[model samples]
Target: MAAAIERLLSEISESEDPLEELRSLRTAVSETPLSGLRESFSAPQLRVIFSLLNTNDKEQVEVCVDVLERVLQVLDPTHLVQNCKSELQSGLNHPDDSVKVLALSQIGRVVSHAEGTIEVLNNPEILQDVIQSIGAERISVSKEAIATLLKLSNTKAGLDGLFHSDLLKDLKDVMAISDVIRYRVYELVVELSLVSPVCLEYCANSRFISQLLEELTGDDVLIRATAIEMVTNLAQSQHGRQYLAQQGIMDKISNMIIAADSDSFSSFYLPGLVKFFGNLAIMDSPQQVCESYPAFLNTVFNMALNPDPSLTPVALDTLGLLGGTVEGKQVLHKTGDQFKSVLKRMSQLARDGATDLRVRSLEAITQLLVLPVEQQTDDLLLLTESWFASLSSQPMEMIKHISTQPFPELHCCALRIYTAIACQEWAQRLMMSTPGFTEWVVDRSVGKGKEAKDCKFELVGALLSSPSTREIFGAQNYLKLKTYLQEGPYYVSAVSSVTTEGAD
Candidate 1:
């Protein structure tokens, strides 16, 4: 085995045309036992091996990269990075695309899970080589280049370096080239656009924006999602959202969404459809909202009201997003009282026995509370009263959630809805004045459950402080309420401190 490696190395080092020698070196590495291969490569060998990357022969670099990929899989890459960093850096900058691809593929593995690779991987000149490879002629090289960028982006420092690099301009050039390559670059674009507003601006007016939206209607699920995701990122900004609406983006997106099975949410386009509209509604116009997604308001509510539990929460979420922005509220109220029916359905979801279903429902209702008054039901008081009607039994349910999850997310959600009600003045008054509700709040706050475990401490404090408490309890009863809070040892509690501050 040593003789074979020695001969192949000698041939690769000595030959004027080393293509055959490169192939022989690969054959030697593969034929060797795993331990033998691990022992064979070092700084001296790597310099000789990597020298071919700078050669004019593409086939030599191609075979060398392919061989290194397989050999590195069987051995610790520390020897490669620690001893031959300069050789690898040279490979990244080599004129040969295959050399750049293979070196980066190796770097991707090294930087991701290993410590101390930050300095080697984040070199500006080297990073520019990786970025330049995004435009490589071969799709495999470009894909590996993107994979390396994403792995490097795992660190905050690397992400910062990438965010400031002027090389991202080539990304548009990359986007115009190949669908297979775009798939890889889209992941980095998503990461960059999410973190930097500057990248978001670049995403807005780029010519490839239309191509991305067009790809949504194509046969590939992942491509459609990536494209819509780019649109979604743009939609996150007020200017971007309005720009999409103006540029007829909604026309393209709506048609794609219409192609999806809204009833069966597991359909390929469902997630992108949901996420895109979520951002679309953020700052868009009423005309834009109504024209793009007609009758979706009716669709989501009907799905949420469906007996099948699976679709209810997602449908409820999409419904809330339709009312998410100022104009979205106008679009929602225009749906008529088929809309009011959604409120009842959301209430049903809040009371659902399934914890996740219930949490999503409460989130939807919480969103509803923020809509403009003219764009809401004429009878919010009735809705609030009805919410209290369903909520009256929830104290016991909150306690039930504690033991169900080791994490307490369900428990915390129930408490969130309970607190959501407490924070609103009208809802707080209605619940406190209701017979037995105030007493339950007091019990939940100071009685049995740990103070941290319970949710209603503030509502009880608010009632005792409100001048209108004379209606819920006579002035005599109101005085006792303050006394109970003050002397019951719940006063100095953390809940009491927050509750007292909110009332004052």
Candidate 2:
């Protein structure tokens, strides 16, 4: 094993093409047992691998790092810090950003374990180098440095090592370099806080949470936008939601949305703010969220009506998400005339708007109309039917017309809307009454593309699978539809012709 390691190291140093040699070294090192590696691996051989980092070739350097990390995994904590720590720390200060990234990545791997974390914590210089790397001019290096620090915070000992000392001050100083860097560190803090209650408490005590909150409500629209996104992520967990609620952050965001109408640049952060509330509504109770913050639903409706291309799609998406569940559909249904007006606007967009807007509108309508079989009640069914009616005087024809358009996206979306309503008795009746509508669904030639075929298949399947289909659709048509469904979406019919010899 020792001789093989020596031979690979020598070949790497001497080969004109070191990448292949380095790859060989990596494979050899990885396949060797850790016990054998521990006994045979020496500082000299480690330095030979480290020397590869000095090169300009990125692939070679990466391969070299992979080899070093494999060998580092076998070393006990004592030997790791004693022999390899200095090499990695030196790589942090190397002129090559790739080397810095390599160094930080290996440090991250080292600190992933308890013993490695303890070893790293004992060495303040190594810790300081990592924190300083967060300010590296290259974004990649800075990101890696932040990741290394995040790994350090995974264990309790590592967490204490980070927050218990002045190291965090170093992190703060680097965060001042730019808003981009600041958010990177902020993301790291939020991730750590999510680890446990104790970690969140540590972050709160460090004033990180307060700083994050300040940024969330700050005057700089861009900063506030970024901050609100992070806070929204923080609000995903029950603990996070609880903490934000206790801090009154949720109310503050709601008020921000309420005040957005007066702010000239509200468009900058309005989508994110709306999305935050949209997610909050979905995560909690749609009824409670929309009722408590009437501004949320109103803003969504207003945005849907607004002509700005940017805001309309987001509003459309949020409405679709809110209407995806039974509770959500009920909440929107309760809005009565206001939601109906929004539905009218969505229907108009689905027909006459830009292609993208048309697709989003169709998707939103589908979400609003779709209800699972088990969850379907007469009220819900009637509600969906009414919403479909509100779309157009002839909603089925409008969507069927769309399905024939050249745009595959619009075609699939229109078919999805059909599928959404296919299981309902009124919808099935509408299809029967509409000329050639049932034939169009079973005919594979009408739709193109995998998505379109699948959607048409689903629509047919919905018709055949519904409880009342046999009564309304007739047995002959049902069997034909059943044959279509049996062959699946991608089925191509086989054609044959017999040719008699010399029979012209």
State which candidate has the highest TM-score.
2
| Weakest 10 consecutive residues of candidate 2 by summed lDDT | 73-82
Question: What tens digits encode model 1's per-residue C-alpha lDDT throughout 1-504?
Answer: 768888788777788887887887788777877777776765587677766676666677678787777677665565566766787678777777667777888777766754535555445666766777776777777778878877766665555555544545556556566775675566556554554455554544454455555676666676776677677876676655556667788777666656565434335456566667655555555456556577444446666767867557668777666545545555665666676676666765565547778767766655555422333344554444454454335533433343244435555554555454443446556565556655555543433344433434443454555444666566666666676566553454354434555675
lDDT of 1: 0.61
Q: How close is every model to the real structure, measured as TM-score?
A: 0.54, 0.90
| lDDT value, residue 381 of candidate 2 | 90
TM-score of candidate 2 to 2 decimals: 0.90
Clashing pairs in 2: none
**Per-model tally of clashing residue pairs:** 0, 0
Compared with the true structure, model 1 gives a TM-score of: 0.54
